[model samples]
Target: MTDFWDDEQELKKNLMNVSSTIESTVATAHGFIRPILLDHVQSVGKMLRPALILITSALGEQEVTEDAIRVGSILELIHLASLVHDDIIDSAAKRRGKSTVFAKVGAKQAVLAGDFLLAKALMLTSGKERGMDSRVVSRALSRLCESELEQDAGQGDFFISHHTYLRRIAGKTASLFALSCYAGVALQESEPTRQMLCHRIGYCMGMAFQIQDDILDYAGSSSKLGKHTGNDLKCGIPTLPLIYALKQERENGQTQLHDLLYQASTPLKEKTVKQALILVESLGGVQKAQILAESYKKRAFSDIKRLAHPQVERQLSTLFTKLSTRSV
Candidate 1:
């Protein structure tokens, strides 16, 4: 099969317009939000969710012929809101190379902005009706928030078990991906089977995407990875690869690894990060994570098969490959 990762070239240009809207939405993000919404945490962000929704919406149609943009905007609002609140919780400074609102505007304003965006997103998701679509979107949003809370409460142990780490990221990140794809199908008057396929496939691919992110943080360059390469470690996040690697070590070995990791914290030092990377690779942790991601990629392709037309289908196929391999 032809590689899909590089195929995003055209899609990127097409979605450039959509991203522009997202940029505008984020700039005005604090305007409609509560008084607490401020500038530090508010700015245009990468329209990742919107793009995902739009692309998925395009699945059964030609070009951007469908109402994918509306669905994309709706998801983008929710995503921006989530990031606002998440940055506060994570005490993060930079997002997409800019200072996060929470770090600049103060937590209270940043948090309220998040709430405001979420409220708007609620209405957007409702559209003309407040029936199944509202319920589905609401439930997914709630789950996504709960996932954040779970991770916040987590100990961030390097030796943390693999299953829990998967759950956290999947819930926080994958849930939104699934919701966007589900909404894409719902709005398009697509088949129920196709809707189900989009949701499952998106979820699987999202999981792979998150896992790949974790791997690259340790494996890629500071410039290429952007932000901090081991930001996950900085946040005390123990992603799947690290967790699995720790599990494979002996009890004393696990203890030593955990000590080394926590003492270093996330975006860990280059030398220390290198040592851990070597350790994880030695134990097949990186391979295990890659294998899991690849499985999801295959599952995504299977789901794409449920949709009709070769062009759109091929586009989705290419996106999944790129998502799994992208540098950042």
Candidate 2:
């Protein structure tokens, strides 16, 4: 897929500012941890959350300011921190085709490095010029923690309903998306209605973004995704596609898929994982998840139209389309 920021030069410039801020912030860490933090920051993917902040902040009457850039950088730091923790939890060795902190430094130091990022992010938030609300940041972080706990607790639970799956992702992933959107407008716009609209737009976009990611785990290639396909299955995490597949199997009075999954070990055997992948595709799980993601994309599009700026609306619409249909 084409880079979403390719056609938008100004947004690209602003994103560069966000990147610089991230690097500079990481540079302040203790010498022992600084290189690791900088390594992860260099591999930051897409800067999607920061992009959302920059995009939505344009909806307001004021020009996009340094404050927006700084806030965007802060959110990206939080996102980076979360990825560090996530890699450790999944025991993932690579991310974005680079060695994960967990793989490079091991779990203990990786955990501290991740915490340092969070602490740095929080410290940045206290700056007097910051436009983003501290309460929103804290709440989003809290939701992220709770959702992660839910997902961890639900491991090997292939029986979870689709509703349960949605809720888990809403917290795990969507909360940051929502926060990015709201922070943009809240920093620039005074109208409550517009602020709320941006929040909803972000929430829908985030939900679609995450569902598509889950779908990719079952249907995408490792080279394209920058990680192994079927990694989620190997880790025994029941994402939407697998959840739907199990539901379909139950309807047909078939337990083959369930039995395969149940018998599979953590970091499931490759052969069994292959079998499970085929069963999931044949049962239409990937297609169903795609449909759900498309629905969210459409909802976000509808709201994007409600915004007054034609340029911002088109940019957002293009982003939503690319995100929903992305292969990587």
Candidate 3:
């Protein structure tokens, strides 16, 4: 298997265009919020969603077009907006090693700035080629909001089933990924089967991506992750590793972990937090979560193999493999 990034100068070029488009889009924001948005963009991550859009667009015969770049920009804006809101909700001061929007502007203006991004995304979507693409974006935005609300409601409630955790991530993270893959192919290919296949590939990959992220919360280094390990536990959010660890503890007739978790209050004691982190790791929570994430990665690879485009399949497979093991 050829390395996907090794030879795809074209894909890299498209991604560069997407980044430029994102910057230009943010630059159009009102004066008060424009600079803040620019700052947030400076610390952008891999732009995986936009990359998915461009990659899947290759499923069709057409060369990558401006429409794909434009749509990629729109998807990235929505993602950035969601992150801004998430930082506010998490009361997080840093993201990707930079001050969060909330930290820079406080919650009040941060909320409006996040909204500004969403509105701009919507405005960009309008007056373009409208059809299933637009509808998919709309539905994805709705799912993202609903999932956030659900997660918010479940905070401090560590008793949630792993199924519930999966459902939440399906909406929170997987929906945008599915939208990105579907939108790309839909723009270039009219074949429904191919479009649906790309969407499934994205969905499985996204699930694995998020599960790996949660696992990192327990097993990864704070500096590498650009945030502290066990931050999720501190926020009283029970992710896959913690959830699996709790189950194992219960099976062993142990409640120390449960007792500590149940007693977790806001501003959780540093001592208790450290203890909980130790318990989760010691009880195989991180290992169990790693296994589950690998399962999803395998599923994604299965779907990727089914794509008719061999080069695209190889690229998607390589991408999934890299993401499965990513540390940040």
TM-score of every prediction relative to native: 0.81, 0.96, 0.95
lDDT of 3 by residue, 69-135 (tens): 8888889989999999998888899887788999989999999999988887777764665225556
Candidate 2 backbone overlaps, count: 0
Q: Which candidate is the best by lDDT?
A: 2
Model 3: residues >4 Å from true position, as ranges?
1-7, 127-133
**By descending lDDT, how would the candidates be arranged?**
2, 3, 1
Angstrom error of the Cα, residue 179, model 2: value is 0.8
lDDT of 1 by residue, 75-147 (tens): 7777778888888877888776777778767888778767777666565443563112667777787888888
Clashing pairs in 3: none
All models: lDDT?
A: 0.68, 0.86, 0.84
| Tens-digit lDDT string for candidate 2 (243-282) | 8899999999999999998876787888988999999999
219: Cα error in model 3, Å: 0.7
> Where does candidate 2 clash, by residue pair?
none
TM-score for candidate 3, residues paired by index: 0.95
Write the number of the candidate with greater TM-score, choosing between 2 and 3: 2
